[model samples]
Target: MASSFSDMGDNLDSLICSVCLQIYKEPVALPCGHSFCRVCIEKCWESREEDCVCPNCREVFPQKPKLKKNVAFAYVVENIVNVKKGGAGGTGGTESHCDVCNGEAAKRCVPCEILCCEQHLKPHQQKEHKLVDPGVKMEELRCTQHGKPIQLYCKDDGRLMCLMCMGGQHQDHKVVAVEIAHGELKDVLAAKYPHVSQSMESVASQLQQVQEEEEQTENSSRDAEDRLEEKRRLVCQFVNESVDLMKSEIKKRKMEKLSLLGKQREKLEKHMESLREGKSTMDKAFQELEAVSFLQDSKDLLKRLETMSHFKSMKMTPLPVLDFSKEEKNLDRLITLNKNFLEKIQKGPEEHPEKVDLDQNNLRRLYGRSPSLDPNSAHRHIKISQDLRTATRTCTKSQYPEHPDRFLYDPQVVSCESFSSGCHYWEVDVRSSSCWDIGICLNSMRRIGVESGLGENPESWCLEKHYNKYSAYHNKQKTDLSVPGDPERFGFLLDCEAGELTCFGDSRVLHVFRGNFMDPVKPAIAVYYDDDSVHFVHLVK
Candidate 1:
C-alpha cells in the first residue's frame, strides 16, 4: 500500500511538470494543491500573489507552500543537454523552438516569402528581397489613423498634408505640389547657403575683434588710474609745502606787530613820568612864595627898633614861564610816533605780492585764458594847504540844510571858450567872524599861480585879512590880479558870523569860524557853475 501511494505522488508530480511543460529545478506547491517551478510560481504570484489556485481544477488553498529543489530534475536536465548535443550537430535541447518557423530554428521574411536561417538573412536582403528605396518609402508612408499618403506641401504653413487635410482644416491655406515645393526649396536653400555661412563667419570674426578691443580698453583704463594716482600724490605734496610757507609768513607778521606795540607802550610811559615831575616842581615854587609873605608881617619892639624902617623896593624876578614849549614839542613828537605806530598796527599784515602762477599750458587745457588784467597802472595823490590865515571877505551859503557843516559845490563847468581864453571866475561864502583862510589850487597841470594871501602873489594866489565887521568883509577888494596865465586860477573866502567858506577849484572849506567869545559853527557852502559864471553860496541853520 505504501508503494501505491508513492506511485500516486509521482504521477501527480509528473502531470504538474508536464502541465508547466518544463523541468522543475525548484518546485513550489500552491495553496490550491498545484505545483510549479519557483520562478514560474513567483511570476504568477507577481500578477496576483494573494490568489493562488490550480489552473486545471480552480481549487483554492489557504497558504502557498515552499517547495524544495528537485535534484532528480536537475540531473535529467544535465543528461538531456548531452543527448541533444550527441544527436544533432551542436543543436540545443528540443525544448526551445522559434516562434516564426515552428521547428526550423529561423525567422521568416515576408519580402522574400521564405524562412531565413542566420546565414541567409544578408543574402536575402541583398539579392532576393525587393527592398523599397528610403525616399520612396518615406513618400509612400501613410498616416496610421487616416490611411492617406501626404501630398501637398504648405510652404507658408511649413507642413505636409493629404487631400483630406486640404478639404478640412487647411482648405483655405496656401499650398503647393510636393514635387514643386521640394524643387523650389532646394534652389532657395542652395542659393542662401553661401550667404548664411558668410554671415556666421563674419559674426564670429566681429565677436573676436570686440573681445580684443575690450581687453585693450581695460588695459588703458588701468594705466589712466595709475597716472591719476601719481598726479594726486604730487598735488598733495605741493599743497603741504605751500601751507608751511604761509604759516611761516604769518608768524613773522605777528612778531613785527608785537614789537611795534611794545615800543609804543614804552614811549607813553616816559611821557607820563615827565608830566608828574613837572607837577612836583610847580608845587615847590608855590611853597617858597608863601614863606616870603609870612616873614614880612611879623611884629616885635626890639625887632622893630633894630630892623631898618626904610622900605626897600623889591625888584621881583619872574619865574621862567613854565617851559611848556619843551612839553609841547615832546607832545608833538609823541603824537607823531603814536600815529605811525597805530597806522602800522591798523594797516595789519602786509599782503604777500600777488603771484598767480597758473601754468598757461595747463590752464589752456582746462579752460581758455582771458585777455584782461594786462593794462598800465595808475597813481593818484591828494594835496592841501598847511597854513591857516584870515578870510578877507564875506560870501554866500549852501542849499542842503541838514548837513549845516558840509560844503557843496557845483563842479566848475568851464566852457571851452573860457578855458582857451585862460581865465575863470568863481566865488565862495564863509560863515564866521574868526580868522580863517582859503586858497585856490591846481590839479593835473604843470604850471600854477596864486594871488591872495601868501604875501600877495608870491607865486600863488591867496588872500589873508582880519574882518571884524560884516560890512568890511562884504566890500570886494580889487588888488592887482596876478595874471600868471599859464594856468592862472583864483577862488574867494567869505567869513560870516557863523563860519568861513573857501571855494577854489576842487578844494572847499566850510563852517570854520564864529565870534571871538562864541563857539564856531560849521558852515554850509555850495558851488554852482554855468557856461559863463561860477557862483558860491554858504548856508547856515
Candidate 2:
C-alpha cells in the first residue's frame, strides 16, 4: 500500500509548477490567476524577444507583472507535501473555503452562485444546482449590462447578443445560435476556397500575358532604335565621303589653275629677262669711254635692237581667269540636295530607288522638259501669267477673243511642247491650293461645253485632287489611285514608244497607263472651279 501511494505522489508532482515541472518552489501568482516558480517566471518575463505572459495560459500582460506569492496555495503545497510524505491526508484540487460557513468547499451551489462544504451544500441543493468549470471566468461568460450569458449571434448587426438584447435593440434581426453561426460561417469559407484560388490563377495568367507583351514591345522598340541608329551612321558616313569628294574636286581644280597660270608666268618672266638684258647693253653703249669699244658695242646693240624689233608680238590665246564663283554655286546646290534628301526620307524607303529597277536619274535626265501654258487655248475665266508657268481661276469676266482652240466653258490651258511618239516628263507644283488638275491631251479636245475640261474629254488623261483624295480621269471616267505623298508635287513620265503614261510622287512611280499613240499630246492643266490654281515649276536637279 505504501509503495502504491509513493507512485501516486510521483504522478501528482506534475501539477506543482508549470515552469520547472517540479514541486512548487516559492510559487508566485499573476493577475491572470496563473502561478509559476518566481525565478523561472521572472526570467521568462525579462526576455526581450516576447511579450510578458503567463507561462501556462499564454495570457499576455501589457506590462511586466509584479509577482506576488500565492499565500493560500503555498499553504496548500505544505499540506500536499506533508500528505505525500505520510504525515497527514488532504483533498487536492477542490481546495476552497465555503462562502456559507467558512469551512472547506465540498461542492458549488450554482443557484446561489457560491461554493459550499458538504454540510452547507446539502441544504443549498434543495433549491437548484449545477457545477461549472473552474477555468472559466464568470464575469466574461455573462454580460455586464444584463448579467446574462450571451446566447445569439446577430447576423445583420454582426455581434454577439444576450437574450434580453434580442427583444430590445436586436428585435426582428436576422440571428442564429452562436454554435450554428460559427459552423455556417466556416462552411461559407470552405465553399469560397476554390473560387478564390481560381481568381488568383486568372490574375496570375493575365500578369504573365502582360509581361510577355511588354517584353515584345520593348524588343521591337529597341530594334527600331537600332535600325534608325544604323541609318544615322550611314548618313554620317556619306557626309564624310561627300566632303572628301568635294575636297578632291577642289584640289583638282586648284592644280589645273596652278599649271595654266604657271606657264603664263614663265613666259612673262622670260620676256622680262630679255628686255632687261637689251636695256643694260644699250645703256653701256650710250655711256662708252672709247670710240673703238663704242663702235663695237653700237654694232652689237644695233643687231640686238633689230632682233628685238623682229621678236613676235606678246600675245597668245586668252585663258580663262582663275575664279571660284562657279564652284561656290555648285557648293550652294548642297542645300537643295539636302532638301531633296529630306523629302525622300519623309517618303520612306518604300519609294527609294533601290526598291525597283527603274532608274529615276535616267528618267529625269532623258525625258525632263520645261513646261509653259499656252494663253490662246486658256478659258475666258482663267488668268495666265506672263511667264506662262502658272494659271488660276477668277469669278470676273474677261474681254479676250475666243480663239479656235480656246476652252470656252472650262478653265483649261495647253503647254507649248507636245509629244506624239517619244518620252517626256514634267513636274507640277500644286502646293498653293487643295484642288488642281494636270494631264496630257491631244491638241484638239474641246472649245465649248462642260466636256471641254481636261479630264472630261476623251482626248485627255489626267490626275486630280479634291480636298485630300486623288484619282485619275480619262474620257469623263475616273479611277482612284493610291496617294503615296502630299499633293504638293506631282511628276509625270510619258513613254510613247512603249505606250505608257506614268504618274510619280515623292520620287516614286505611282501609276502607269498604256495607250496607242496617234496624236501629239500637250501637257495641260484645268482649274475650272472653286477658285483653283495650278503651277508648272522647276526643280534644280
Candidate 3:
C-alpha cells in the first residue's frame, strides 16, 4: 500500500505548471479538476475572464476557484534540489514563488473574493467564492453612455443606441430597432443589388453596341464616298462625250460650209477659165492670119492689095455691128443660172412683182362707166373726176364751198363696183353752205345723166333712192336708167350718230362710214378703200 501510494504521488508530481512549466511551488486546484501554480492560475483567470478549463483534458470550470500550495511537493522539490544544483540552479534560484506577502503561498479568486492555497481551493469555490457565468454577465451589461439598454440600430450611422437617442439628435433621421432594421436592409439589398449589377452589365453591352454602330456608319460613309466617286466619274464621262459629240457636229457643219463655198469657187473658176480660153483662141486666130499674110509673095501681095482696095472702093457700108443673137443667148443663160442660185439661197417669202394685169372689159361692165370716158386717159379717177388726160378738175374758186358741213361730190371711176372684188374710192372736204343743196340733191338721186332731157321731165332728171332700182338696172339690162319723179338727191349722207353712209344714186350700200363727231363743228370722216386708198375729210358745220 505504501509503494502504491508512492507511485501515485510520483505521477501527480509529474504534472507541472501549465504557464511556467515547472513543478508547482504553490499549487491551486480548479473546480475543473485541473491544477496550476496558485499565482499563474489566478493571473490567467483575472486576465481572460473566461471559463477555467483543464489544459490537458479541456474540462471546463464552474467559476473563480481558490488555489493552494502543495507543501509536500515543495519538500520533495527541496530534497531533490541538491541533485539538480549547479552554480545557477540551487533551490533558492530555481524556485518560482509569489514575491508579494512572502507567507504561505495564496491565490486570489476574482469572482469569489478569496485567497487560497492548494488544499482549500475546491472548498473555497464551494463555500466562500461567489460564481458568475460569463455568458449571463454579458447579457446584463449595458453601454456606459446610455442609461437604457442599447437595442435599436441606425443603418446610415452604423450604430446601436437606446430609445432615448431616437428623440435626441437622431430624430427625423432614418433608423429602426436592431433586428427590424437589419431585416429590412437585407431585403432591400437583396432586391436592388442584382439590378445594379445588371445595369453595369447593360452599360458594357451598350458600349459594345455603339462600337458596332460606329463601324457600320463608317462603312456606310465609305460606300457613299465610293458612290460619289463613281458618280463623278460618270459625270466626267458624260461631259467628255458631250464635248466630243459637239466637236464632231461643229466639224461637220464647218465641212458643209466649206463644201458649199468650194462649189461656188469652182463655178467662178470655170467661168474665168472660159473667158481666158476665148481670149486665147481669138489671139491665136489673129496670129494665124498674120502668119498667112507673111507667107504670100510680093507680087501676090500686090495683087491681093489691089483686090482689097477694089473691095473697099465699093459703096457697100458695114451694117450696124451687133451680135444680138449670141448676146441674147448668153444673157438668158446667165440669168437662168442666177435664178437657180437665188432659189437655193432664198430663205423666206418672195416679194410680189410690180404689176398685175386684169381683164379691164369685164371689170368696166361690172362698174358703171362715166359718160366722158377716154381710152388714152393718163389720170385714173379712184374717187374723183378730173380731165382724164391732165388729172385736173374744177371746183368752187373759193376755199369754202357752198355748205361748210357738206361733203364734196366727185365722180369715182371704180374698176370693180362689187364689194367682194373690192373697189377704189375717194373723199373730199367741204366748208361752204352754198354746196349743201347740190350735196343733198346728189345723195337723193339714184342715177344722174349728163343730158338733162334724157329722163322723164325735160328740165329735171329722174333719180331713185332705192337700191333694187340700181340692182335691176345693172344686173338685168346692164345699163343705168332713171326713175320717174326725181327725189331731192341728197349726196352720200354720213350719219355720225348711226355710223353709216347712205348714197342715193347707184344705191347698193356702197360704203359704211364711221366718224368721231366729238367736235361737230369740224367733224373728220375717214374713208377706207379696199384697194389701199384712204382719205380723211373735214366737214364744216
Candidate 4:
C-alpha cells in the first residue's frame, strides 16, 4: 500500500499548482512545505501585505517568506509537462466533443444549451426545437435585449426578431414566422433564378460582341491609316510632277521669245551695215571729178535711202508679254478648292444624328420642356387663346392688326420659346385636330405664298396628318408613315447638338429628320380645318 501511494503521488496531477491549475514552472516551496509555481504564489500573496499564506493548504505566515527555486520539484514538473504533450495528438482543435459518446459534436440545442453527436442529434431534432451548428453560440440565437430566442421575422423591416421584439418596436411592421419568411423568400429567388441567369448570359454575350467589334474597329483604323499615308504620298508626287511641268512650259515659252528677238536683231544689224558702206562709197565719189562714179553711187545711195526709209516706216512685231491671267485665275480657283477641302478634312466626318429609341417616360424625364404658343406669330385666321397656350383656326379671318412677324398665308403659329443648342422636348395635344402639321421651323421661314407652308421649304420639318393618312415632310419631300392607332398627343424631341428632330406618338418614333441646324428653331403648328385646334402641354419634371 505504501509503494502504490508513492507512485500515485508522483503522477502528473501532483505537479500542478493549486492557483494556476497548470504544471509548475520555477516551483517554490513554502514554510508548510506546500509547492506551487513561483510566479503564481507571488501574485496570489500580493494583496495580503502582512499575512501571506500557501494557496493549497491555507497555512498562515505572519511575514511573506523569501521564495527560492525548488530545483528538484521544477525538474519533476518539466518532465510531466513533456509527457502530457506527447500523450495528446498534435491536432490544434480546441472544440469540445460530446461527453456521452466522446465523438465530434454535430449540432447544439439552443434552448437546452447542449452539444449532441449524430446519434443524439436525431432525438433532439425530433422535439422540433431549434438546432444550431456547433460553432454557433446560444447568445447569438437570442435577442440581445430580451435574451430570448428569435421566433419572428419583420417582413416590412426585413429583419429577424424575437417574440418580445415583435411586440415592441416591430409591432406596427408586418411580422411572420422566421421559417415561413425564409421559405417564401427562397421560393421567390428560385423562381427568378432562370431570368437572372439569362440576363447575366445576355450581358456576357454582349460584352464579347463589343470586344470583337472593338478589335474590328482597330483593324479598320489601321487600314485607314495606311490608306491615308498612301494618298498623302500620291498627292505629293502629283503636286511635284505638276510643278515640274509648269516650269518646263515657262522655260519653253521664254526660249521661243528670245529666239525670235535674236533673229529680228540680226536683220536690223545687217541693214545698218549696208547703209554705212553706201555712205562711204558716195563720199569717195564726191572727192573725185568722176560724173559716172558719182551718178552710179548716187543712184545706189538713193535706193539704199529708199530701202532704209521703208524699213524705218515698217512696224516691228511687239515683244510677246507672257499672259499669266488665266494661270492666276486657275491658281486662285485651286487655292479656294484646296482651302474648302482642307476645312472638310479638318472637320472630319459629318456628325450623323444619334438614333435613339426612347419611350414616353424617358423622353419626359430627360428633356421635358414647356413652350407656349406665340400669339404674335399666329396668322390672322388662326386664333390664339388668351393664355397663349392654344391655337385654333376660325372660319373667318380675325381682324387682328397686321404684324410683320405674323404668318400671312398659312394658318400657322410658332412657339414663344426657341432653342439654339442642347436638347429639348415638348408635346402637343393634337387629338382635336384631324388635319394638322406639327413640327419645328426657323424663325425666318417664309410668311407669304404656298412656300410658307410647314415642311414645304428648307426652313421647316413637320409630321403632317392629312385626315386619316400620315406622312413626314421636309423641304417638300414627303415620306408616308405607318401608324398603328390614332395618337392623342405628339411628342417632339429636338436634339440640336446632334442636329436631330424626332416626332413620336404613343411611345413609338414616327419619324426623324437630320440636318444642320445653325440657327435657333421654334415649335410650329398649322391647323387647316375650321375649328381645329392644338394645345401646348406643360411638361412636369
Number of the top-ranking candidate, with lDDT as the measure: 4
lDDT of 2 by residue, 126-174 (tens): 7656544322235655656788876778999898878888777779899
Go through the candidates in order and give each one's C-alpha lDDT: 0.39, 0.73, 0.41, 0.80
Cα lDDT tens digits, model 3, 125-238, are 676553322112222323445766656877767777878788876787778876687577666655565565465555545554666677899999999999989987996796
Ranking by lDDT: 4, 2, 3, 1
- The regions of model 1 sitting more than 4 angstroms off are 1-159, 163-187, 284-541
In candidate 3, stretches whose alpha carbon ends up further than 4 angstroms from where it belongs are 1-187, 272-541
Cα-lDDT of candidate 1: 0.39
RMSD of each: 52.7, 36.1, 60.4, 31.4
* Backbone clashes, each candidate: 29, 0, 28, 0
lDDT by residue (1-541, candidate 4, tens digit) is 1112123443658677888888788888787878888889988888766789777778888888877556556654554454333322211224757646879887788778988898988877899868865656677777788888888888888887788896687879999998898678766656665565465555555554666677899999999999999998997897788778777888988999999899889878977787787677667766978787677667766876777676666567788886667766866887798899999999897553233456667778888998988877899989998888889989987887867679998999999888876788899998789999999999999899999999999999999999689999999999999988999998998888779988898878899899877477999999999998999898997
lDDT head-to-head 1 vs 2, winner: 2
Model 4's alpha-carbon lDDT is: 0.80
Candidates in order, TM-scores: namely: 0.25, 0.33, 0.21, 0.39
Off by over 4 Å in 4: 1-152, 162-167, 171-180, 270-315, 318-320, 344-541
